[model samples]
Target: MIHKILNNKCPHCDKGHIYREKNIYFNFRKPKMNKSCSHCGYAFEKEPGFFFGAMYVSYALGIAEAVAVFIIGTFFFENTFDLRILPWIAITILLLSSFNMRMARIIWIYLLKGV
Candidate 1:
């Protein structure tokens, strides 16, 4: 499960790339996508606005990440009321935004594929 999410492979074949580019860092501007899987020829676009559902998944992921940060800060930093953790958490989420978006789409595809 983790391997599939980490690699962002096509759920059908588990081989082809989903995004047009392998590097996630570069896609913010173009949001490039392949028409179909290179390996199995699976269509990435299920329907128009199919990825709209991915937004909700991404939102859930962001919330989960924030909650995790809060828990870890409370336990490890030993300070729930510490003001320093706010910016730290924000920075962490900022840095992880791209990775989280990528993973959220991957997870969303997996969820739809299983159904």
Candidate 2:
């Protein structure tokens, strides 16, 4: 499940890649997705501006991740509202931005397109 989603495989066929670039770490570029699945020819965009809704999903995912950082940071530092942990949270969020972007799109597809 983790492998499939993170790799950005086609949700419908699970065969073709969703993004043109697969090397998330080495490549500094954003995800460039195929317009349709290579294997089954599934339309990735679905409709015009379909992925625009994914922004909302991304925002939700970010909030959830931020909350997790707050909880973990508070527990680790033994401070409920420590200013020191703020930088840590910011760094964590920045480091995971790309992953979050891809994951958020995957989540949006899964939610609207079904698992």
Candidate 3:
């Protein structure tokens, strides 16, 4: 589960990518999904509202990133409140956002099935 989420693949199978382009920042603004999984042929979006739960996954990923930053700065850097650290936080969030979006959607797919 963790590997699938982190790898940004379909939760059921890691052999396929959740996206076609390496950069989702470009694709998400317009929104496009592959016709079928390259490896497994699993459909990524099954229905119109299939990705609503992905919001939760994105939220979780955000919180995790924030917490990780907070902890690392607090313990390792010894400067928890420095404004200079803001760029690090922002960059980390931005860098992870694209991957997080895909992971979130994948997580949603798996969760609905498990329930």
Candidate 4:
């Protein structure tokens, strides 16, 4: 299941892909998902707003990444309460926004449907 989520495979059938072929990590454009599994014909969206919950997951991931950046900055600079780390945290979040979105959606899907 973890492998399936990481690889963006369909929850029902791990052989199918959840997203279309694209550079979701670095591309500025929104990543595209296949409407259904090419191998098993399983629909990606369970309902009209099924993926809406993915936003919360994305938010959580952003916060986690920000905290990680802050911790790393503090460790590197030996400053526990410095404001200089704020910009680095923001930049890291921005740089990883696309990946976070894609990962969040994949995780959400697996959580809801995978065994």
The candidate maximizing lDDT is 4
TM-score of each candidate structure, all chains considered together: 0.83, 0.84, 0.68, 0.91
**In terms of TM-score, how similar is model 2 to the real structure?**
0.84
Write down the TM-score for model 3: 0.68
Per-residue lDDT tens digits of candidate 3, residues 1-115? 7766555576556787776666654343534567557788877778788788789889998889977887777765666676666778788888778767866776777777554
Worst 10 residues of 3 by lDDT: 24-33
lDDT of each: 0.78, 0.78, 0.71, 0.85
lDDT of 2: 0.78
Task: Provide the lDDT at 5 for model 3.
Answer: 57
How displaced is residue 80 in candidate 3, in Å?
5.3
Model 3, residue pairs in steric clash? none
For residues 10-94, write the lDDT of model 2, one tens digit per residue.
Answer: 8788998877886753444678878888999987788898888888887887788888998888877865788888788788778
Writing each residue's lDDT as its tens digit, candidate 1 over 1-115 gives 7787777788899889887667864245445667678999988778888888999888888888888888788876756677777887887778778877777777888889856
**Positional deviation of residue 45's Cα in model 3 after best superposition, in angstroms:** 1.6
